[model samples]
Structures are given as C-alpha cells and as structure tokens.
Target: MLLLVVSDNCQNTLPVELLSEVEINVDCSNPDSDDLIGYIERTYVVQDAEGNISDPVTQTITLERVTIGAIARPADIIFPFDTISCSSGYATDEFGNPDVSVTGVPTTIQENYDQASAIFDYIDISVPGNLILIGDDESVDVDLGASFPLFDMTFNVISVNTNGFISTASGDAVPDSECPLSLDPNSLANTNGARIYALQDDLSADTTEDALAGVYYEYMTESPILTPSGMLTGVSIFQWKVDHLEASGDYDLDFQALLFDNGEITFQYNEIGTEMGSEATVGIQSFAMDDNTTPLHATTISCNTPNSVNSLSAVGLIPPTMGGIDLYPFPEGVSCNGYSQYNDQIVYTDSCMTKILRTFTIGEWRCNDINERYFNQMIDIMDVEGPTMDQLTDITVSTEPFSCEANVLLPAISPDDDCNKADIVIDIEYEVGSRIENAIGDVIVEMPLGIYTVTYIATDKCGNESRMSFTVTVIDAVAPTAICDADQISVGYDPSFFTAVALDNGSFDDCGPVTLAIARTDDPGYPDLAIFTDELEFGCMDIGNTYEVALLVTDTANNTSICTSNLMIEDGIAPFFADIPEDITIDCTEDIDTYPFDNPTVVDNCDLPDAFTVSLDTIDINLCGESMIERVFTINDSDVSDVQLIQINFVNQLAVTGTIDDSPVEGCDASDAPAQTTVSGLVELDGDLLISDACVELTVTSSDASTGTCP
Candidate 1:
C-alpha cells in the first residue's frame, strides 16, 4: 500500500499524522488575495505486507496569483490613436496621475508576397555596328551611348559575355554552370555586378562561320517599350547568336535581354534549339554592395529550371506594390500637421513586432505651465496553451472474408487551438512492433493482420504539440472454405483403406495453416465400426458399393467449414473355381440319380464362399441306342461368375434269345415233334438292338413214309 500526505510546512521529522488532500480557492476579483497564493509539500511512502516501510518521497508545489486587466483609456485623447500628443501642455491618466511612461515588447510578424506577370515589347538589334565577335569564356564591352536602368542602377556601358549573359558594370562575365541555377544572387562566384541571364550556361561562339556566332547590342535612346512598370522611353537590347559548347551542328541559340529605362528587365527567346537552354539559368540577380563594392546582401528572381518560357515569349519581373495590412489603434479625428509643437511618439512598424508574448504600453504627460507629471499603463498578450485534440480509442477489426488485409476507416480529427485553428497541423503515423511504417491518411488502406500503434499528433503555429496514440488490432476471423473433390473417388478394394485427405480438392484458409478432416456421410450399415475416422476400411461387402463422405477444414482461428463428396469401392477381378474336375463319360446303364464328381472349389478375390452361389446343370442325349450326359457346374458372386462342364455317356448293348415250342408238333411228326421239329425262335433286346431274327424247321416227310408202311 502507498500513502500520500500533504502539509503547508516542511517537516523536520516525519509527520505521524496523515493528510491526504489540500484545497485552495483563488479569488478572481482580487489579485492580491491570500487564498490565491501559497506553497505546499506532498509526501509519498510505500509499505509492504511484512510491515516494512519505505523512505518517504516528497514533491513541492507552488501557487502564484495573477490578474487580467483591460486596456486603459484616458480623456482628452481620441478613441484610437497611432501616436499620443500633449499639445495642451498637460496630459493626465484616467486616475488624474501625471507621471507616465510607455514601452512596447516585440512581436513576430509574418510576411507573405503575391506576384503577377510582367509584359514586354520585342525589338530587333542585329545591325553591323551592334555586332561584336566573342569567343568562349570571353566578354566585350558595349557602349550604350545612354544610361540604361537595371536593378536600381544606371549604366552607360555593359559587358556582354559569350556565355549567354550580360553584366551592368564593367567586368568580365562569369559562366554559371550550376544546375537548377542558384536562387541566391550573392552566391554566384567570381562576379560581383548585377547580371541578367538570358541563358547562362557553358556556351561557345566558335563555329564554322564567324557570322553564325556573335553578340549584338544596340542602345536606342528613343526606343519606347510598354512594360508592367509602364511605357519606357529608353532601352538597351543585347542579343546572342551562339551555340552550346557541348552541342553539334545546327544546334544554335538566339536570345535577347531587354533593359528598360525603369529598372525592369525582360528575357526573350527568338529561337531556342533542342536542349539549348535546358540546363541554363534564365533569371536576374543583384547584390547589394557597400561603398567599396563589397557584397552585402542579395536579391534574386527565379523563372525556374528548364526554361518554362517558350520561344517568341519573354519573362520578366513584375514591380512590387504595397499590400494591405491590419493596423492597431486605427486613426481617429486628429489634425497634427497644423499643430506648431507636437509630442514625440514612437511607432512600431510591422517589421519590428514579432513574438507570441508582447506588451503594449501607453503613456500620457501632464504639464501645468512648467511642472510636468506622467502616467503609464501596460497590457500583455500571451498564449502558452497548445491545441486540444480529441481522445482516440483503440480499434479492433477483422479482415475481409478469405483475405489477409482489411480496409479500416479512421475517425476524423480536427484540433481546437486557442489562437488559430487553421494554423494547426495534424499528422498520423502507425508503427508495427518497433518499426514505423509510414504516415497515413484518414483511412488505413489494406492494413494487414497485426497489432499496430497509431499516433495522431497536432501541432499549432507556436510549435505547441499535443498527441494521442491508440492500438489498432487487425484480426483474422474468417473461416476456411472446404472444397471437396467434385468427382467421386474410386478406391480399389484390394488396398482395403483410403485416407480422408484424398477427398480434399483444395481446402484453404486466408490467415494461415488449416487442418483437414473427413468423415463418412452415407450409412455403410456398420454403425459399430469406426468408419468415421480419417482412414476408412472397405471389405468384401463394401466392394461395388459407394458411400458419401464430408471434408471439414478448420483454420488456426478455430473457424471451420464442411463439404461433401462421394467415395466408391470397386472390385474388377472375377471369381474363379480352383481344381476344376475333368470331363467324364459313363454307360447308359449307370445310375444317374446323383452327381458322380465332387464340387470344385470356388475362389473369389474379395468375396467368401458363403457370400456367393453355385449351380449344377445336367443334359442327356440318346442317338441310335446310345446316350450321352453332360454336367455343367458354375459359381458366381454378384459381380462375376465361373463355370465347369463334365460329360457322362450311356451306351446301349445288343443281346439275342431264341425259344422253340413243341405244342404244334403233335400234328406233324418230325415238324412238330418238338419245337425241334416245331421249332419257334424269338429275338429280345436287353438294352438296344439294331437287328433281330427267328427260325423254325420240321421233318414231316420221314414220318409220313413210316405211317404208310404201318397201314
């Protein structure tokens, strides 16, 4: 636990009693009130659970009293005055006091300039006496015959250089090769005089023909030129027809500088070849010089690089004019010009007042014949407070579905400043971990998933800054999409097992890695089996059967999705009969009531014998007392079948029997005596007979002869 104690006086030893708070109310009406001023001390100490006490730490606070007053106005003075006067010999304050003094603290003044375009008239100066032959890095003096005004100076003679510029004073021209051409006039090395660069570059007047390169100048006393400063009476025209030192054939330059009698100059381009004045300086420069010609300060006019001015066109400086300003203590009715004796007054111009804190003092003098008294009043203006920025809360967002980035719209911030809101500048930047990315606008575009610290800073014109920071958490919340294979997967029954990963076409998650899972959707009629696992097994029953399965995809964010696909178990092999019996033949008299051969073994690649069926078919044919029998055995599963054939032949055999009867032989002695005499024969077949025969014979003639002998 920590304890805070406050006291009005510092303690020689640690105070035993604890004072937690102190309050003091300031009286706004009274600047010297006792309650408005004081000092207090606060002491802090920490104690641990073991009753150990820490050393006391102390902080001191001071309070001060302040008063804000209005501006003092005295009678006999106009409402607003730029300068106070006491022409009546006696001036007094509002309280009638006559002793007074006035003082003013400095204030910062910001100056801004607005410019317009200048106009010019072109004149030709290519005559014979005007032509001067100049070479590389050389200059020639040309007598203008009259004073020409340029940069607050009048010159009767000017030096024209072959390097595309002219100097107002008598001196050798300096070739300025500085790219983008220095904007500071005094920074130009080696040349001190004011210069007009129509095209200042590394130039050459040397060519195949001398006439093609020359410096021409003519000062016309009666030349009239219309300009932004008005119509000028006299003018000096300097033209250069030269070539760049680095250019080849036909790459020439023709430009002119026009110096008006009013100190205004213009540069005109007659014919600017390709890259003629590309890297050249086309502007004016003037250095403020002391009496000894030592450079003191510089002024410059930049027409910018690459010569924005076109051919047949001219660029010049527009003379400045007095702009408007807001004045304090505006003028009132007071005619001081007619007064014989006036009081001295100090006037602070805009250039002299510059600061955020300033004091303005007004004084009045009171004079009665010879005795004088003075009184003064002072007013202060101060601004020490910074702009007020709105507090920002942390932002948490999710990325777009299936995307790694999100587009976040930040809240708009408009800071409130006590001085000027328009002068407040707001900046926004984001940092990831310890690295700063870049300044962003109101919207953070395509912000990837991460934790970022975004800080918004507001700075006022006085350099007072206020900043607020917040965390932006871009999260991944979108689930993965599970895409099952569109086609049904055919798994061979021989392998027995198939994995769930085989069913995934392309399961994806936007943020990171995803895990794939699969389960059987269709009923395989085996609920007790663990068929819903990642790997599924198929057997003889599952062969030629198709089942539905689903794929589940889950992302790191614990978001999941599911899709379904079909799985088919296939068996292409046919069942066969092992140890098939050979074809057999049997006689027709053999018993055919039962099968004579043992059943062949049925072998199936994926099915058991109980799961299949077998059949036996027999056929018999008889031809010409002979019969044949055939036994066909077949075994079949639902998908495939096999067959075996056995043959049995029944053959018919021929047998003959003969009988002779003697009953009819009683009538004929030898013929009937018997069947030997009355012999009768019959043919019978035990099986099948192709042919039969019967015969009988008698001896009646011998018996008739014996009966005739007895008579």
Candidate 2:
C-alpha cells in the first residue's frame, strides 16, 4: 500500500512520518474495474487517525521497481540497500514534552525484518513452529523487548519435534538450525526437509496506503543447500558500508546474530540457549560470524582488504558472501577487532587519535546494533548535571553581653567536569542586605540594627568558586536607668531628705524587665548606708553631713541595671525631748477655757522661770481621720520645721573644739565667740540655755579652756 507522490513544491525530502496504514471505504457505486489512465475527478477524501477527512493524497498507485541488496534480516529496511538516504529523523511532541525521535528508516523491507526479529525475538522467547501452537511462551521475550526491540520471522524447521526428539514431520516458520546436532551444518550441517517460502514482497505489492509492511515473513533454505553429514560450517562474515549519510561521515555501530541446529527438528522449547552476548561494539568491520559450536556462535572479524571492487578483484575475488552479507565488490574476509569486559574501564580517546574498530561478545542488541553492522565514528555525546548539594539544621547565637542568631543550607560539593579548578572553599557569609547577617557558627543571623552586607562563598571539587551575598540589620536595646530625682538636704521641713531619697519603684528595665537604683550621685561606687530604723525611715539620715551612698537594682537576667541619688548634708540638731516638770503639778483641766496653753507651758530648765512652767489640754478625735483628743502643749520660741541642732557639745554645755562664724560649712571659720551664746535641752545636757561659764569644761574653737567660753 506504498504510494510515493512527490510535489514540485517539495524537493529532495521524502515523507517518512507520512508512512502509515490508513483504512479506506470503497464507493461500491463505481464500476468494480481497474482503470489505468482514467480521469474521474470525483471528490475522494482520506480520513486521519482522528477521523478528520482530508483531500486524498493524490498519487498514482502502481508497482514500484524493486531491488534486492546482498543483505539479510530484520526490524528495518532501507530504501536503496546499498545507498544511504540523506534525511532527518522525525519527532513529535507529547503533553508538551519532547519524546523519542524516529530515526532514519532503511527501506527495501526484505531480510531486514528477519535480522531484527532474529536478534530480539529469540531473546527469551521461543519461536513457535506454526501448527498446534495453541500457547507460546512470550513473557521472557516480551520482557526482553522492554529492554530491546523484537522482530518477526518465518522459520522452516525440518529435524526436531515437540517431544524434543528427532522427527520426520515438518512445521512452518521453523529454523533449520533448531534440529539435532547431527543436523547442524556448523558442527554437523543439516539438510533435511529443505523448505523454500515465496519471496513475500516480490510476488505481492502494496494493497493499502502503508509501505505495505511485512507481517507474515519467511526464512527458507539459501543456495549451496547444507546437509547434516556435510563438512564443518565455513566462516560467515557481515560487512557494512555507510555512504551519503544525511548529516555526517562516520558513526558508532553495533549488531546481534542468532543461530539454531534444526537438522533433526525445530518445533519445541526443550533446548537451552548456546551463547550470550558481549553487547557493545564501536567500529567498522568486514566479517560477522564464526562456526563449529552448538546453538551456533560468531564474532566480527576485521579485514586487511580495502572497500573498493578494484581492490577486491586484485585479491583474486570480489566481495564474498559471509553469514548473509554480500560484500559484493568490496573486500573479502574481515573480523570484529576484539571483545570488551563489563568492568573494563575505558579512557575515551579523541576521534582524531584512534579511528580503529571494535566489537561486543554477543551477536544481537538493539541499542548496540542500531544498524545491521558495526563501526567507530562520532555519533552523539552523553549528558548529565551530576551529583549536587544536600541539607542542614541547628543554629544559635549570643554575646556574653550582646548576641544574635543565624542559619542556612550547606553548599554542594561535586565536580561538573574534572579539572580541579573551582572557586572559593566552604564558607558561609551573613546577610546584612536582605536582613541576614553572616552566620557566626550555627545560627541564622537576623537583620542587625545598622546597615551591612553578608554573602556565602563556596568552591567545587574542581576549585570552581561561587558566592551569594545578602543584607542585615541588628536592632538596638533599651536605654539604661537614669537619675530623674536628685538627692537633697531636709532643711526647715518635714522629711525633706526622706522625700528626696531615690526609690527603686521607678521603671528600671526598659524592655525585658525594669529595675531601679538609688545611689549617692556624689559617691556612686559605694552601697547604701541608710539604716532602716523607726526614726531613720529606711536608713534616712539627720539634717547634718552624711557620707555618699546609693541603692542599685537590676533586671531578672541581670543584664541591664543602673543607680542614681545624691546625699546632701546639712546641720543636724538632735531631736528635742522636753525635760519633765520638776515635781510640778498640773491643775486639772475640766474645760479647755480654764487651762489655756497660751498662759502656761513646760520647759527644759527650772532656773529659767520663763522656760519652767507646765500646762496641758486635750480635745476629742473622730473616726473619719479626725483628732478626737487634741492634746496641746507650749514650747519655747523656735521654727518647728527648721533642722534641730544638737546644742549638747562634748562638755555637756558647749562645743568641744571648732567654732562657727555663721559661715555655710561648720567648724571652718572662727569669730569673736566660737561657742554658741545659747543652748537648751540637748541629748545629755537637758536644761535651758546655760549662761553660767562654770558649767562648760572644754573651750570654744580650740577645746582649750578660756574664761567665759560658754555664753
């Protein structure tokens, strides 16, 4: 069904992909007669795989001149068996992805299929002998097909039966080599029930649209009929010539061959396979097979002869027939250079260096034997990204005082090629740009407060360097504690210094936790000395000079802390305690109007009659914070809010040493009178202002007695 129609619009190219079977519907109304040159332009259409009708591919169907090449067997058939076709392979997309491309096809579908099938079909599959072939084992064969391509063949067995014994019965599609050993030509040539099938494609022509693909093929006995009792099977060779290739000159080549000994019978599966394959071969060769072994075996043989008919003729012969190849006008005998082992390491050499040939151990393999032969030239190079990088975990950070965190993935360590010339070594950088500061150790650094940059750098096994950079910003912490309230003296006031004390009640920690620190701003390095007494109020001092002190408080983590306070000193007069009236009786006061505090009073000294009187009065108090009983009394003239000075000096009356000149600082200056002119009930010297000079022992300003030192 092959119809090759060339258009004036298209040049040398042929429709390779267009070659396929297309079912046709006959218009029975037309006369059932063959019209050679009839002109009837009725709109005849052709339907595609999707059932879309297209204008019929107008072509005159007729017999194509056929030619047979001096070749044999399977899978594909070339157009001009001896001439290479210059064409590009066809490729189609599947699901938007590229799939495998259909390589160039060799037309002249004769023994090509036989060859391909022989190699793949017999893989693990038993060739059926046509008749009671109710069931045939195709699993091993099909599975093998998954790893290779299978072929279709028509075998003619003459010597073996289903019982695995020699038989006189014949079967279609049988291999003569499957007979008993006494029938194999190699070890013992087989010559029984010689069969000859009709040359399929020659007698019949394409009846459909496809290239009239060969389905029911055959393999009969060839010339020089072999007999079982004949001499040892002569050497058979396979020679291939690649010319006018569409793209390049030379190429990689490989092939597979199978044989059987059916001189006795070829119908069953009781036989074991004879030999396995070496598989890969890269070369141009002259010979194809060997002999003298069961189940048959062969290896490619090289030739000392050239590729021309002139050279072959000079050697006393034209291309001789080996295996199934007709070297024709080329060299005679050739060989497959040698076999390579599986673990055999190969140093890929440049084509410019060694253009020699090579071969595999076995005879057939689809991937290996792309063509029906073997050669050594450039075809295509292998591809790959090759081993790369992996993963990472656990990151942390800190400063004894300040710190942060950083993390990232580990870079890959492998060579793309093998030159040992990569970039930087294993080093990770911080990102201050994208907010990633450099990782210190196992931490992924967060953005820092200020502006900065970070980048990870790495090198390949080949020393190829690569780096990635990023930005980061580290944040700032809260401000330390400060002195909002200053320390001062309690002068002429109630608890002026007590109110002046800096308390830790204020916010200390700005972020995590707050704390307060109270310290003498004058002497901050020391701790607080204020005693927590009933009179001192948490270590509060009197209104005189006091040493510098403070209280420091910190946060929970004890990382942030501060202190602030100033200790101001002023003149301190001891607390005044009135002396008990000298056995004085206070008149009972039944009414507030009778005992008036303004008219009567209790004093410290009795000698001073004005300061020695006694009086008392009381009022009532209420529950609502009101004083029910207001006890009242009268004291000598003095500012109640002023700092009380201690008039009791060392001698129980006056100053022991230094004198005051009314200057700001005590004991710094001396005037005409160093001791005070008046003194009242002090700590140990309870009486009113002592005017008698005999009462003091120490002198004023110098502690040396001088007459009338006490005023």
- Per-residue lDDT of candidate 2, residues 605-700 (tens digit): 112233322333324322222222323333444332111111111223233333333423233334433444433332232122223333333222
Per-prediction CA RMSD (Å): 26.4, 29.9
Model 1 lDDT per residue over 1-711, tens place? 234553323333443433343434422344335533455566666554445556666656554432111112221222111122221223543433222323321111111111235554556676563678567888888877677655334677888888888876566566665544443435556666666677877888775645557778777775556654556567777888888888766537778877766655667787778763466777655542322222222223343345554667666654333212111232122111111111323233222121221223322211111211122222222233456778889989888985888777766677786454666777766654332222334555568888887777776666666778888899888879889885443434555666668778878998898877667776554232334467666666776677877777778877777888777766655566677666665555555565465556766566464644546554544444444444445454354454545444434333333443324323324433422232233233222222332211112221221132322
- Cand. 1 Cα-lDDT: 0.55
Instruction: Rate residue 211 of model 2 by lDDT.
Output: 26
Span of 10 residues, lowest total lDDT, candidate 2: 137-146
At residue 166, what lDDT does model 1 achieve? 81
Q: Which parts of model 2 have CA positions greater than 4 angstroms off?
A: 1-338, 341-485, 489-513, 518-547, 553-557, 560-564, 568-711
Which 10 consecutive positions of candidate 1 have the poorest summed lDDT? 333-342
Please report, in order, the local distance difference test score of every candidate based on alpha carbons: 0.55, 0.26
lDDT at 200, model 2? 6
